[model samples]
Target: MSAMAAPREHDGADEHLMELPSMRNPDPPPPPLPAAPPRRGLNFHPAVYVGFWITLSSATILFNKWILSTCEFAFPIFLTTWHLVFATAATQLLARTTDLLDGRHRVKMTGRIYLRAIMPIGLFFSLSLICSNKAYIYLSVAFIQMLKATTPVAVLVASWALSLSTPSLRTLGNVALIVVGVIIASWGEIALDATGVIYQVLGICFEATRLVMVQRLLSANEYKMDPLVSLYYFAPVCALINGAFFLVLEAGQISWVNDVMGKVGLPMLTLNACVAFALNVSVVFLIGRTSSLVLTLCGVLKDILLVVLSILIWQTEVTLLQFIGYSIALAGLVWYKLGPEKVLEHLVLLKQAAMEGRALGVVAVGVVTVLLVGVVWYAFSGPEGGGV
Candidate 1:
């Protein structure tokens, strides 16, 4: 009887344990994730070509300044207007020509797409171009470059604020390093010239936001659109907008146009226009190919080129301090470029999507982009224009 009673008691205890929530089942094993494929190596050889591309861009700025200094133009506004007009014409021509050659000219989208997508991108890009140009009018090339070095940081912040991407500690570290570098680079210069520093900072902020928006829009939708298509879409709109602005804001100032154009030979003027167009296109193409950090590093290299050119051509004086700051800025850029930090993860995500067969169309579109960009760049470059 005692043995039977003990057995019943043990069975009751087992039933009670089974009834409890914790005793239902042990923790299940985690689901296995698909293994990510190894990244293909980007040919370093392309970067050498990219270096030449960057030098061309840096030269455009100097040329813009030289034109402004030599001509009786309306400063920032005139410089920007000519840039917009030329870029618009160039992009439209090239975009149409490329489409014609490829036999892939899709009819321009009609209806709300223009209002919703096309105009906004164009206007914002124009705003970015104008703001940066305006800032350069006030700031030194070195100052603008140094401040613009913080672009990746600004982009990171913008992405996080928009909930497009999550903030990471590594990004924070890069941002910190960039801020330190900028402060050091600008310490003496800003002390000597506060207004220039202010404009430069404004340029950095605007340009950074512009970078974020470009990547976000490209990643989210319109991945199938050619990179040049954005230029075609944006350029004419920018020209129209600025054209309207010039009409309203500077109607009586039309004489400045001829005055500015008269300063350089027709060839140099044409070269300037071509350079501006090519630089803008190259920037858009590169942003699609790599992260913003990579593009900004390219910009830093452009700045370095500008500094050397400024010394040689403009006969600008540089002290030991400025040289040291320039070196430190370049070092920071190199470190950031080499480090495993990404300012625009969306670009990488797009590539991953392409790899996984999720976004094959996007990759297909970019396949011809590098080649087309090369052609445009070569066509636009010559000895007529020293820089800009």
Candidate 2:
């Protein structure tokens, strides 16, 4: 009986070991020299093979100016009306195409989760657009672009306050660089009244705040519905809410429309509509692709390109200081890109790891990203006298 029991125990042990094969190591292969780690290389997408990003970004700025100059009505109102229309239409069309191609569920909105998910995002999206458009009115496109560079700083502050994320000293240094870049970019215009500076700062703060809120909202909740489905529903809601606001509270100021919208022709309307649509889509894609810091910096890039184009096309005056600031900002961008202790790569890696379910790695990468950003902010922060 003892021998039989022993045999059964051995059989059971073999079955258990077979079931947990992962715990065992396989036979070793022939010994060989260790392979070297792969070298890091700078790679660009196919579309960016010929500096497509630079080209598209430059084009975006030119389009902004063209749309603004072409439209007769107040910039924000016209932007709001057409942007929503185009976004709604575009997303709906895209959704139909996606469904037909993929044979997925046909854009169902029956879930309560869908409504809960989209409301905050849709609202913030519209608010951010409105704030940015309004800021353009109060500030020079250059000044606004300069101040908008502080978006990274805003996001860091929000993260620290909310305990959502912690940023490193390097990141903080980059934020400082951004502020300096903005100030240097606008140094020529610094002679303007203090009120103008205040407005620019406020605009920057608002845009930054909006960005943080957007990131937070997007990250917190997950809806079962498709992204296009949500976008399709959210668009009309945003348009309706913003349209109502424009009508009720801002309607009194609508008298300016006739002066600006004098004989709105089809061609002009089509052009403005296209501009507004492109702006929204580009911004959305930019935010999706990179950090808000990157988005803001991209704005700086766009502004520089626009300045050059504006000078060439319109012969606009760009003072020497403005040129210096642009140079400094571009240099800072290069610095951030090359520095080993930068947050950009770490942040990208962390984001990828999070998406891939490597939680432990995410923690390490996120910490590194934050530290790099903080360092960047500190290095680029204001000078000893507190001036950018």
Candidate 3:
């Protein structure tokens, strides 16, 4: 009787222990999250930078065209001078008046550096601006943009020639596609002006040379500058050069009769300058945060939009061949951005598959190839298989 009683007592104690709230299952507390890093300046969504750059660039181009062509301003030199002058004044105001741009780089502002290095670059810059603006007078914005699509070719060639970048056949081949596309576009142009084409080509060359020189000079000096600092340094020199050209070449051409400001009034001109400087700031911000590849893709997208916008706003007539060629050039730009090694690997696999047994890669490649070809055909030829 005693042993049975003891066993019952032990069982009752165990049941009581289980009934206590402390003995029940409970959820574990959540792990703590790490703190976020602080942003340096005004916080913005990443798209802000890209959006501003694209819109500003497009606006500047359109504004310049309207001033020089439609308004019959016919003063490319003076207009360029105004842009540089405004940029210089605005940059100085931001740097000195406001504390916006760090504004405290310690570059050696020697006369030698200014005359030998900066002056030459500014000369090329001035010429490039003048020529591109002049081209706007003769060629439709759509056509001019189509020609500018070959900028990558000029950049790659110049970079390789200057030893700023390594040479690669794959790179060359990719850019060759771009050149081929531009050729096609040129062939199909409705209003091909000799002077316009010459101006465009000269502008491209000058622009490419300026880029290479910048890389070489700045890198050799171990000096890296944000776009603002660059503008601060170069704008004055560019302004002086452009101003001289204006006095020499354009003073007599302007009527000075239309309130001395043409159709785009003084207020509008000031707004344009503000937008242009904002674009410069946007470019600096973007390049600081993103990769070169991202910038290239953004540029390609901007070009495409500019072409379409030209058609919509200016009623620029785009031929089927021009559209097809622009598409091909854009495709090549995409390929170039994919990296040369990866593109070659795919191509080699394609060839090997053709020579040997078909593989999964071949099927994938064939599918993409077919898809691209079909799209091109459908775009160039009408829905009913007739040429446009």
Error of 1 at 242 (Å): 1.9
State how far residue 94 of model 2 sits from its true place (Å): 2.4
Go through the candidates in order and give each one's C-alpha lDDT. 0.49, 0.44, 0.63
Q: CA shift at 147, candidate 3, in angstroms?
A: 0.6
Clashes per model (N, Cα, C within 3 A): 2, 30, 0
Candidates ranked by lDDT = 3, 1, 2
lDDT score, candidate 2: 0.44
After superposition, the stretches of candidate 2 with alpha carbons farther than 4 Å from their true spots are 1-45, 48-60, 66-72, 98-117, 190-203, 218-234, 255-264, 276-301, 333-339, 342-388
User: Candidate 2's residue-wise lDDT over 114-150, tens digit each?
Assistant: 4665565556555655555554444444445445445
Model 2, C-alpha of 6: deviation from truth (Å): 50
TM-score of 2: 0.59
- How close is every model to the real structure, measured as TM-score? 0.65, 0.59, 0.76
Candidate 1 lDDT, tens digit per residue, 1-388?
0001111111000110000000000001011111112224533454543554565566577767666544434455545666667766766576566532121144246557667766765565555555565555455555566566665566567667766566677657655666676666666453245665665556555544544444444443222233345555555776787666667766666553365455555577677777766654443323324433444445454565565555556444444455456556556554554454443464576668877777564654464355334323332352322221
Shift in Å, residue 277, candidate 3:
1.7
* Residue-by-residue lDDT tens digits, candidate 3, 127-235: 8888888888898888888887676677667777776667777567767887888898888887789999999889878776776666556543334444566778788
* Most accurate candidate by TM-score: 3
Residue 376 displacement in candidate 2 (angstroms): 27
